[model samples]
Target: MTHTRFPKAVLFDLDGTLVDSAPDFIAVINRMRAERGRDALPLAELRPVVSKGARAMLGAGFPDVAASEREAWVQEFLDLYEAELGLHGTPFDGVEAMLAALEANGTTWGIVTNKPEYLARKLLPLLGWETRCAILVGGDTLPVRKPDPLPLLHAAQAIGVVADDCIYVGDDERDIIAARAAGMPSVVALWGYRLHEDDPFAWQGDVLIHAPAELCETRAWPGTGTQA
Candidate 1:
């Protein structure tokens, strides 16, 4: 096996990449829609924008509403969801094991998610991961977020790893963009929540992981004697 140059650290996105928070998010979206006398969207429809933030989900679920109205709806959605956060969310299968593998290998791992820190922190304990993660950089942790690279850079700094020595794994384009901008290698998580219109293979990350467990296998990491 060809040995790929393994990174010293791996930063992951929380919502879709590490945890299956879509169900929890959908529940909140539907609740908000119901309160507004509007019909709730099916899980499939809302799943598409799970990574796009509350604003995108609000706009998609309330397409007939004006932009200003949507903004208010978004705020309401966040507020409501925050109250019931993590009720239906859980880490993806093999997530704990994967994290363990990283720890065993002496590689640092952290979370750099677009989710607000309070909400993200709230979920960590339920998954029994509150203290395991080396660094937790949330949407509110810094002034900027994914697709901007600042969060990724900050996470790398917090984890004591350099951009080139770290890999960022996420289920969205923003994750790849952030990794690229931060000069880190990235993997597209195919196992996470994805829209029907999206294509992980074409997202152009360093690698495309098929499942959560696959990540723990060093063979999947390029240059680790794994195929490119």
Candidate 2:
């Protein structure tokens, strides 16, 4: 995974890696629980599952619900989340500056997340990333999603960059798995949501960065002589 030059493109995971959407999830789920006369869970209790997506969050919020019932509640949760998408969420610290740095260096950057396309697109405009992002590949954009190389490969193709010429940054193991399968180098964003049981080292990302600011330094990137 050595590289003679910096990556031509940088692809990011949305929820946890680029945007700190945990606040939004916390607000929505708590509000939903309140409406059902259920006690609100602590924000800390739910934050870790944010990267795991809606189902996990719902399960945490409604622990007694049946699996089939929880599945039904997912759409309800998504509906609530969409109505207030960017109201409570903001990009992770320094994400905008990192993207700007990449742009100034002539490196195209985009998003490849497990979020649905509609919601992903909706959130971008709210964050003023509509024009800044070179491409976006949502979970449902293809038949497969993260942990599968197709979405990552498709994003590279859409941006006219070879898979090997891209670097994928995400907070989850699935993100690393997908990048590895795509033959692209990857960085694990340690600042993102994760449970106590989660282990970034076990994920084996090419680099582990504690914040988006680290991305501005080429030496901190994978294939740049940084430790994996």
Candidate 3:
């Protein structure tokens, strides 16, 4: 049961894991609020739910909007976010070094996110990931998304890696759920968004990392150099 120091590949969750896109989300939400004369929400208040997607974000930004009307609100949020995408977001600290190390070692990597395919694709060049990212599977790329495992499995195959040989890094509980179901090892990104209610330990990830920098040192990886 030995493992390679570096997995065959690493699959990341875009919003919270690889990139700190919360600022972009906040900009969009705040702009929407300002249009209605509402004050801006502190970044801290909205950061925790960024990975939960548009509806959750709109829920916080427009509390007065009825649940039934959320469908329309969500679209508006997305439209604004799409326009704001790549304008404010940047890779999380240490992510560049980690990805550099992976590429230096010839370990392939990709993104699997719940963001719409068009948006994710549109975000690639802006984030300088258009050619760097080996593969991408958006929320709508497949019939189902994370918490379903299909996206993770498909991403692995697309990059020529088997599920068990890949590592999935994400900020949400559903990320671990999908990785586990797909037979890939999961790393819980502690630096990613998590409300006070989130208990990453309870998620039972294979590894829990405090920052993207932790992955920069190849020897520091769990099971690194352990493979026979």
Best candidate per lDDT, number?
2
The 0-to-1 C-alpha lDDT of every candidate, in the order given, reads: 0.82, 0.88, 0.87
Q: Which has the higher lDDT value, candidate number 1 or candidate number 2?
A: 2
Q: Comparing 2 and 3 by TM-score, which wins?
A: 2
lDDT of 2 by residue, 86-164 (tens): 9988998899889887888788889999999999999998999999999999999999999999999999899987888
- Which candidate do you rate higher for lDDT, 2 or 3? 2
lDDT of 3: 0.87
Per residue, candidate 1 scores C-alpha lDDT tens digits across 1-228 of 434434478889998888888888889888987887987788888887888888888777877888787876666787888877888878889988888877877778889999889888888888888888889989988888889999999988887767787888999998998988998888888887777888878778988878778767776774321211
Give the candidate number with the greatest TM-score: 2
Number of clashing residue pairs in every model?
8, 0, 1
Candidates sorted by lDDT, best first: 2, 3, 1
Worst 10 residues of 2 by lDDT: 219-228
TM-score for each predicted model, relative to the true structure: 0.92, 0.95, 0.94
**Candidate 1 TM-score over all chains jointly:** 0.92
